[model samples]
Target: MSGYVRPGNSQPALLFPFIAGVVVVLSVLPLVRLAMTGLSALAAGGAISVLADRALWAAAYYTLVTALWGTLISVAIGAFFAFVLTLTDIPGKGPLGFLFVLPMMIPPQVTALAWVQMSGPSSPLLKALGMAPPLGSPQPLYSAGGIALLYGVQHAPLVYLALRAGLMSVPRDGVEAALLSGASPFRTFRDIVLPLALPGMIAGAAIAFVSCIGNFGIPAILGIPASIYTLSTLIFTKFSAFTDRTFGEVALLSGIIALISVVGLAVQERALGRRDYRIAGQAGARATFSIGGWKFIFLPLLAVLLFFMLVAPFLALLAGSLVPAYGVPLTFQTLSFHAFEEVLLRQTITRTAFANSLFLATVTALGLLALSVLAGYVLSRRRDAAASLVASLIEIPYALPGIVVAVAFILVFAAPLPVFNVTLYGTIWIILIAYFASFFAVSLKPVVSAYRQLDPALEEAARLAGAGFFTRLKDILVPLIAPAAGASVILVFLIACNELTVSALLWSTGTQTLGVVIYNLDDSGSSDVASALSVLVVMMVVIMMLLLEGMAKHLPAGVVPWRS
Candidate 1:
């Protein structure tokens, strides 16, 4: 029925070709390649060899345990912030929300590095404060628990965003009616608000779980040192020890990661399968509970969490960068600019990484913007089965782990091109192609939202006057959605610039990205240089966030993450 129904606008036919192209390049080709490789490996007994390895099973167990624990922690911290910030009158909410989300925007490896600097017997910050652990004491964060903790801190904002939407939708009349009926605050929440918000919480948990499973940076840095391997890191290690069976082995691992991610989504769907999330009236002002005495306590509680989440780790990272060596104290006499000087000026690799990351990010952001604008227009205007399929295809590449996408691209381009005989297997072009596939969803979301908010009458009027598709799009659609388009560009640019997992597998000599560079620097026992580079990366992320924050008022709701 949907397939036959006329779409909302005169430009309905344009959607098919455009959406088909994206689906082919990003979703259909890569995923098909991955499945074929894995299934072929199984048929050829390549997987049997991998199955016999005890480390594979051990990594699977550790991945599940840590991801489960991390999801719980994320739900707890994220729900608390979502409830307090959205429902109650929290002071400095703008600042609080911004700082709370910084962990997500910052690179996962950087978060790992910061927390590493903040603790441990080897920390300069700890040594300077005269609070160093005893000699030869193991770093506590190298365990499964430590890795899970960082996973929670990194993904908590996802839960906050998801839950806040459901909370915002609760009918004001319903809340007031419950209050007038003499229901206690706790009782009302348990009976009325909690049921409606459950779906959001479940969805958020699923997202957090998938994120934890796909995460490469956190586990690679923290888990590898202690010999605690997750599925993601296990794949990286397989690449490092390249053999004739390397392709088949990594494909099997990617399949396992994909299965784990699908299971997380399936669990969420099962939990929410039969529930109705609708509230029957307009959402007015949210009901405010009066608790004069609790503010004094709650405010302080919030402040402490914010401090540990944001300030402490950053301060630790700053201290690490200032010291001349890894374990050296940061006294005025010992502090030096040598690390910064080396990363910025002396290391040719560092400069090349910066340039490559910037170039790729810029190209991906700008290129995706052009395609997404057209794709978003079609998706928002057309209501059909094909459109739905197109959307799912777009999401598959982004939703799965970056490592999976990287592997898929590698398999697809491993050989020279058929016609031109050009090789992209070990070039910057392969990485660029992977980025386009990965970040399509990020660039499309805001634009689709923008398109939905517009009335079709403007375009219809243009059509009636004999104006063509391109003319109407330029005059009617583009102007209406420009703010959101800007948001999309900035969001994609920031993410692409700091990405590592995809690049880690794909980068060759002279093509290393910022993420690959940072990971390598730390791995090579140059953490002082790593810290210095990380500080610069963190500063760049902050600047981009501030730019979006300044444009928040003009953009549509939910376009700027920190804004209400």
Candidate 2:
């Protein structure tokens, strides 16, 4: 165990302290400071004053309402795809699955922008298609229901991924036995598959609900326009108008968001409690379904959904970028490259945003990978209480909403350091640190999973042969787990590049990320520039996904999301 363990098991197990130190600096310190501040304010009647504001409770209520509606919609749509593709004979399952999930890869704000351009009286796409609504009609997507709809669309793939795993575990022998016992297809599904899949569906709902509640980009783009707010957005607004009371107020809101997230996880935990979910041995097989005439119905319905989910909004986004202004009808003659040129060349902020986002994203991904590789290797070999505590600490930051994490980092770094006398507030380093805290789990999970699948005997042999720890890592562990490390890097990079919630609050003038720039451009009525930037973002996401898809052949199964 010591031989295969990271940094060995001596008192000087440097790996443990290194990991613990990281968790302390990145996760523990920030959250503790925020909690301490909030607690101090609560002792001073800050909670009462903050809670007295009608907007805060209204935002909380709106947050719950939208999250509930969004979860239901996601389950309805995502479970359909998950079940049909996994359990039925759906045609083009690969392409359908890929298309169904593309919306999730696109950022939430981009999703909102695309849908806005696809709907409403001001839609360039709608006008070009001669389907624009009449004058003076409101932008339908600016309503609470519209926000819920887009949230559902954006988070459905999360539900799909969660449920697909359960669907895959449905035992074929049981279905065959039921059929032999003269059970109808409906009866077999009702008795066997649905019961077995209930836990997964419930868990998926919980995941979607948490995501919707934490989502800042969607509501910031859609809800704020209608003067609506969720707890996440309310926190942002409170921070935007920073004041002496701002820290306490935002900390109060962040506590509410954290509570909401905790409730969600608790519900999932309760739903999943103590149940042995393993299917019988020899259960892995294709879903046993034969609905010959139902093919037409299933395939076409899925195709239409794919079109709406992936094709339509992207085209609308493209059209929005092409038009000279928001409501102008897009035509071959009307379309021009001015928006693209201005964004890609002329705007200094655009250039800064690109460079900053790329730098932050790359650094976060690579840095976390280095840390996760060591931590994952160590934790995989050691399952003591200390390791579990460290693991739990690492998860706390990622489990909280990005907004809460941002607020925590704000509290942690708001003041100048004790001896250094240098403050990190309003700096790019702050955002980078926040990204590390926010995305640490995303980077750690894949590598840990890969470590679990590896055998320890080879490393033990290396130790018996007197090879150093670094030598074994270089000659043994790194070569074997490289693909998982790559996957971890890509996942973190994808998420960090598309991040808006944390940066929304933490960003200063020169430190804007892609998400901040997109939101700001739209907020300032530069719809053309926003749309152009969004189009570029969408392209980048797709390209990176394709890159991951290409690398999937060399990787273990389930690393690349789109790959079957």
List model 1 lDDT by residue over 284-319, tens digit each.
Answer: 446555656777987888789878887888988989
Candidate 1 yields a Cα-based lDDT of 0.90
The whole-model lDDT of each prediction reads 0.90, 0.88
Residue pairs clashing, model 2: none
* Candidate 2 lDDT by residue in tens digits, 382-492: 789999999999999888889999999989888998999999999999999999988888888878888888888888888789777788888999889999899888888
> How close is every model to the real structure, measured as TM-score?
0.97, 0.97
